[model samples]
Target: MKLLRRRGAVSLDDRLAALEEAADLADGRLEAAAVAGARAVVSRAGARRSLSVDHTVAALAGATGSGKSSLFNLLSGTALATVGVTRPTTSTAQAALWEGAGSGPLLDWLEIPNRHEVDGTAGGGPEGAEGMAGLVLLDLPDHDSIELAHRLEVDRLARLVDLLVWVLDPQKYADAAVHDRYLAPLARHRDVTVVVLNQIDRLSPEAAERCLADLRRLLDADGLTGVPVLGVSARTGAGVAELRALLESRVADRRSWADRLAADAGAAADLLARASAGAGAGDSGDRAGAPRAAEPVKAPETSADALAGPLTSALSQAAGVPLVVAAVAKAHRHRSVAATGWPVTRWIRRFRPDPLRRLRLGAASAPEGDAVGRTSIPAATTVQRSQTDTAVRDAAAAASAGLPEPWAAAVRHAARSRADELEDGLDRAVATTSLGASRRPVWWRVAGAAQWLVLAATAAGALWLLGLFAMDYLRLPEPPVPTAGEAPWPTVLLLGGVLTGIVLALLSRAVAWLGGRRRARKAARALRASVEQVARALVLEPVTEELSRHRRFTEAVSEARDEVRPGRG
Candidate 1:
């Protein structure tokens, strides 16, 4: 029996621990803590040794003057607990130990100092007989005592005892306070409770039988019908031996310990299951209604087009015609040269600007007197601060509208906050966008200047060489040497000037295109980050919070039940 009780207690503790862990995972921390506390209490109760005697340990509990003490003394063959006095006498718990192996540890754990070690007299018998071993009789204080300590002690010890012998005299057996406060609440523990009709000696046999039947009916009404009932008289010892024999049988079997622990665990499991079910119900709302698919709207695509158009237009205009056309023409020329032109020149031009550069329309001026016509050049529109801000705000609002109520509000707030951050990023992007603006690196400027100088020097050399070749080929007479102020315009020099202007235009366009792409990438990244933040705030966060709140409410309900009815079977 002792081994079984310990095992049962361990099993119950494990179940309680598992329940608490589940509660924690479900975000019911408060409930989990409560369950943990309950588990600890139960573990302590389980660890406390069971009565070791050969007889079954039973506690006789009742209201004041119910003759429970008198019945205890008559059964244990000693006047250990005070009786027969009108004054409330049993202040602390008292125990009567029949010859037993396990009674001492259990009594010590119960903190019952007063003990009567019975020998082979009264109900005591052979050390290992049905009536002798495993019995630890407890005379608990009146549960109805006005003294709070007495009631508390009685209630505290009630949970640990194996069998509760509720002794009630004929007069107060049907008392409302007793049945409502004690019996009805203990309905879950009915299997371990045995109601005894004490003081039946005062009634005639027929009256006693009728009273016993009425008591049984009351117990049934109290939801305790299945619990055994015995009519007895402490003064006459009527039915005492029968009760003793029943206790002996219970002790011999040793299954009641496990049964009691299982009952406790089962009750706890039921409560936990209900809580889990309630949590599931709360979560089920997600699947209850028709799935509300977000209606696809054409407006977002339109808005994207609207927003991108201005920026693209601005880029095209900033990159003028001389830059765009010249870069494309140069790339095409380079490709042709690489395929059919001299190998040495092809390698040299490999470092030259490609067609993609023309798309960029870089910030560079055309050569003087060689400028492309304004009509052929696309002009870039300067982006206004206010216009960009408005566009961003509108986009954020459009996304926020798709969210649920409270979440929608939170999304709006987040959008507004994030919009400010995005605007700051946009400002930085714009500031960094122009290659020739305040953000231009020193190396780029130096490189541009060096390239221009090299082109100028090359043009001068080409002109000089072309002039020499033309003079030699035409076999023209050396005309009179002209003064520096009188020098004629050389066709070769003009052609070289044109070529240098073309090279500069192409380089400018390539730079502009690269800048545009970089800005576009940055803008796209910022937009994506902002959208993700809004989604989390508006959808996921709200759902998680609601689920957590539901868990807490369920826990509160459980706590309320426990408070209203402590020491449940």
Candidate 2:
């Protein structure tokens, strides 16, 4: 109980729910048999819970000549089952219900047609029959009978019973067939099981004690340490009273079926855990198998953060981010030359194509929010495609490292599920990114306006000189030709304006070059960011989701298999 409270009071139903969830999440990633067994546990528990909540079903199971039928008749106070000593007696299961109320459905669920109803004061029965009003005792065929049908009947009923009373004789208590085929496989059901050394009257007291001690040793080795063991003689009515008290106590608890179902679910969950972490796929989950070194199943060491850097870098190269960045720098310079160059020489740079526009990734290509634009960037080359595949595979392998084979395969598959979309996604990301070239700088405008002013001054001075020449030729006096020192005003204006415009154009070009380099770096950062998004959506996210599923599945399995240690008997 302390363990239960410490673990947050996880009930048996919660454990079953956890196991069912794990089974759902790991349908194909776990062993087929193991998964099927878990489903069976859940289905059987639901059926049992719905059938008869008030009754406890305990089946008497033993090998041939173990006097199983005699004991069944003795406890039931009637010759309901035929008894035989040297041969098999009960070839089919027989049930004896107390009062027989609302038990038809329960019997039908157990598939038992031969049944009897016993009253509290009917015959010379075991005492306290009134207290066992909810008990349902079953007599099963010999598990070691020569007839295959009889053995099969015993095996089937044994699994469905709420409690099992295993009847062993002093002669064959250590029988290999019974121990290997039954007790060993049912080690997890210790809480819902009891052992009876039948036919003890035939042996001396010392011999019976020795056999009992030996049987306990065997039971403990089979992982049934806390289960009760009793020595009884049906013919002499030796320990039958004690067995009856056990039945009354179990029925009084009114939760034997619940305990049995919990054990079943726990066993099934353990099977799945072993299947997931076995030495190999399809390894046997049998508890009685030879001992081997235990293996701990740990979570994978890799995560998305560890894989994203290399993956995004490789994908960026594949998406042509470097080429696009270079084009952005050149396109900036080209546009800047037209906007800031001297008015007289601006046309010289017009013939060169805008690098960004040629790739359909210019500032004009990027659209408004949430809209993707098309691009004419060349398709990936063979080398680029190969590099992308290698990087993606490496990422998948690293993400799934240390997982079981099926889970690892699942992670790898998820990593590449979006491979067909990577090309288009990367292109859309590149074309839609804001690549720092949509508007010209304020400096470019100021330089261009200044250049135009200087050019206008130069043009006016030329016209003034032409007029002075014309006036002299026509014998008219020139209008007050002003001079600055040794040079005339028009001559000085013409030389200074032309030289100033040339110098301003050179200065503007130099500034644009430096600005273009800076813009290239910024554009590179933006383009890589876009490509990184593509990488996550296409590959990294899927891998991370799959790993999360694996973790959930394993955690559920652990919880489902965590049985309470104190009351396990």
Candidate 3:
């Protein structure tokens, strides 16, 4: 029968365990000031290990002139808390400990210096007090006291008590200070809270009912919909039994502390959950309604995969991959033209520098040590540097778009974690990439040999013609010069060799231009791949790890938040 009634209610142990988990999740995500109340709940719950579970600590709290002390005395059946007609009574919190329970450590933790034992026959009828053996009733200073210290004492004890019985007078039942400062904030804590219209004897039955109705409306507006409200007169003892019965029921349960702490954890978790929802919706200032589902799940809007393209592109540009590939293509054409051009002008072309060697980078320039070495390439221009920085920041923002502030900050940190090493790392990556332009093409060697043969033929023909002219000039007998139909053989050989070499050089230049473009494209692809690898190692990996941490934290906090159902057990 008990299980059926408490089917959906979480056990005390489960609630405490969940509270512990939630507290850990809130450490950095929520501000320490914002989460202080929840941390106090966890700390008090742990402190309860040394306290007795059988004891129920209840406090009577009210604004000035509310008869809170009279109610406290009536409940304890003793004059422990002083009563006065003066505006403020009970400057410090006073506890009435029933004799059967040991509350030494509990009172010490409560920090109440004034305590009275109310279990003996001297105070009143022992039978009534005997039934409330494990109860510890406290009379707290007026919440609206003129003395700041008295109000501070009330505020302090208000948080430590297991159950709060707010005592209000008929006239001041709708006071803004009480409802705004206390009741509204404790809306989620209604399960462990009660409101009593004290000194109800001042009003007739109809007037009492009307005041109660007005108070109920205020409570509902304050977000305390189902909290129990009663009417009682401490002076005439009318309706005092009902208030005592309520306290007795709380004491009998022996789970008031657990329920209070559980509700506290729930309220704190709900605040965080709503804030996160508002952030995910892109309106961080909005106050989201209470979570409707049992489990609160956060599906991050931006994933690591979505960050790859922008990050890689930025790193590629930062690494000077485009400039390096352009140099490779130019160098390939320069070397090819020099090797396969006509021999007459090839030596002059050699005076110009190889574009790749000018940069001191290529497959040949990789550093020998594990430390990344800088390339001798020229520094990026101011515009290029600015663009790189902008790209990195944009990628970080894109990767953190829908995440909570903490997670977004984490992603930004991860993206820039190795920023100082990026210039050198990217330079090293470019230096190590294979340009494929290093190996000379076989056709260049063959074409060079052909050019040399043409040069030799041209030289031989010219020498034969010079010998014939010198013999004629000396008036000596000359050998017969060969003839090719209408033209002299020496002149035809000389012209054909020079013209053929020029034509071959022109053809090779055209082929080199086309092949150089293809080589440039290949080099670009290879460099981009290397740049992508560098991005993954330095930037994407850390962002991915942060995302994983965020997912785990969300799940843990969600589990804790889901465990504390406000109206449920």
Candidate 4:
């Protein structure tokens, strides 16, 4: 029954502000039907507040022949509403203002053209308006009237009035139409509702008490257990003074308007909470699934982290990071062979293509004058695309696991907001990554230099031997040669030079192979880092922002729910 029973130190403005914030935050994240009541409350409260807090508008409503109009005349001390000549006598609402002159604009807003000025003397009420100065009492048309428009009039005024007096006859007080259609729904408005048993003068005291008891039972079943119920006879003036006193007190307090409005806001806020909170609560539960006003809801698993892992994997394949890493390794080995190969065959290695350059992953692969551009990596295929979409939707589902359908849908949309840019972004990331393949290792250069020097020595030794042969054959002088032991210097140089070059080349090849693999692993790591950045921009960040909104929305709803609710007794 806390349908907006606002109780606490919170001011009216603060409560309304919290409600407004919730409604605004809920716009796209909650269903329209769920938040519609909230919007209406805000509007109605604003209008009612701007007009008057000094006045109280109370409505006397009941089925035809219940003497509701007679009671209205008895309390207000005027015959503003017609009394019992025919059924459906009051076709429209009639207002009786205790502070008559100043309430025209308010009555106009209420659309009650037939307003009477009550001097408080006509019905044996207090002699002046001082007893109920700011009361605007309405005698609404008969709710049970066969005339459709008369019934419609009663229903219309019922919602607008600050206080409700459900006048019932002894015979029909327990009727289902009255109990089911009006009292049951207004159970939450108990503090501002009153039930009067009219025509009780016909019953003896014992009979009247019994009727009152039976009526209370009916009201309790209608969920209006604590609502005020009294016996009054408009024809005999029995208990009319008591009814007048009740009305006067409510008007003097001048809180019924605010209380009524607060009740509305609470009901609307309750609905909003349920809609935002996920579904699955049953009938005895809040049908829309109530959101708790407790501590903020936490992510069991962070959505961004959850989304990034699979997205990064998908993007890596899409961007050709694997291809680039492979090229880095092959290119490193290719360069390695050139750097450490036999001098005679080193030139042959140049004819083979540089794997990194062919894939455009190397600096040399950057076009002669263009930007580090798109890679030669294949586009993401249908299979990869499907996997990526699945990952995003799954992440959304997890992030919004317990949320209502509307909020979950919002999270999904946020996840996919930038999905279309994934492929291009990942490709750019791959292209600009420094795979470290183009740069040569320091050892390669040193080994290459050593190979050339040995080749030079080998040529010199061959030339020295040729010179001796020529000298012996054509009468030329021979130069002296040095040796380590018995071997001539020329022979030693030739054998040592050829042998050293081959051995050095073999040793360098081993080092270069290990270095190439290491560099390839390093390149793979770098490319992955780039892919992660792309995944974050294209996928994870949007999810994070969506979650942020969700947190704020929940917090706002909680504030409305937990803070001092205004408008309760």
Candidate 2 per-residue C-alpha lDDT over 1-569 given as tens digits, one digit per residue, 9 for 90 to 100: 11122354457777789889878877877678878888888888888888887899999999878988889888888889888765567788989888669989999999999989887764244355786778899999989888899888888888789999999999899988888889977777888999999999999999999999999999887778888999999999999889988888999888889889878877777777777775433453444533421232556667577798888888888898889988888888888888877788889888888898898876655345657666888788999999999999999999888887778888899999999999999999898888978877999879888988898899889889989999999999668989999899899888989899889878877888888899999988888888888988999999988888888887787667764455432
Q: Candidate 4's residue-wise lDDT over 490-531, tens digit each?
A: 998889999998899889878877887898899989888888
Task: Return whichever of 1 and 2 wins on TM-score.
Answer: 2
Off by over 4 Å in 1: 1-10, 19-28, 31-39, 49-56, 124-129, 201-225, 236-238, 262-569
- Candidate 4 TM-score, true structure as reference: 0.84
lDDT of 1 by residue, 394-481 (tens): 5445544443333334334443554434333322223223232223434345545644564565667567657767887999875543
Indicate whether candidate 1 or candidate 3 has the larger lDDT.
3
Runs in model 3 deviating more than 4 A are 1-32, 35-41, 99-102, 120-131, 273-300, 303-306, 335-350, 364-369, 400-422, 439-515, 533-557, 563-569
Tell me model 4's lDDT, rounded to 2 decimals: 0.77
TM-score for each model:
0.53, 0.90, 0.77, 0.84
* lDDT, candidates in the order shown: 0.55, 0.83, 0.75, 0.77
Arrange candidates by lDDT, highest first: which order? 2, 4, 3, 1
Q: lDDT of candidate 2?
A: 0.83
- For 1-569, candidate 3 gives per-residue lDDT tens digits of 01122466555455445556655655565455434545666677678656776788888899878899888878777787788878777788888887635788888888977888885673336766666778888888889989999988888888778899999998788888887788877766888999999887888999999999999988887778899999998889888877777777888887787677666666655555544443321222311222232233454566555777777787777677778888988988898889999999888988998888787765453556755456778777777777777777787787777776766777788888888877877887887888887878888999899999999989888997898899999999988877999888889878988998999899889888888899999989888888887877888787777666667656545544545346665
- Model 3, residue 21: what's the lDDT? 63
Query: Residue 328: error of model 4 in Å?
Result: 2.4
Clashing pairs in 2: none
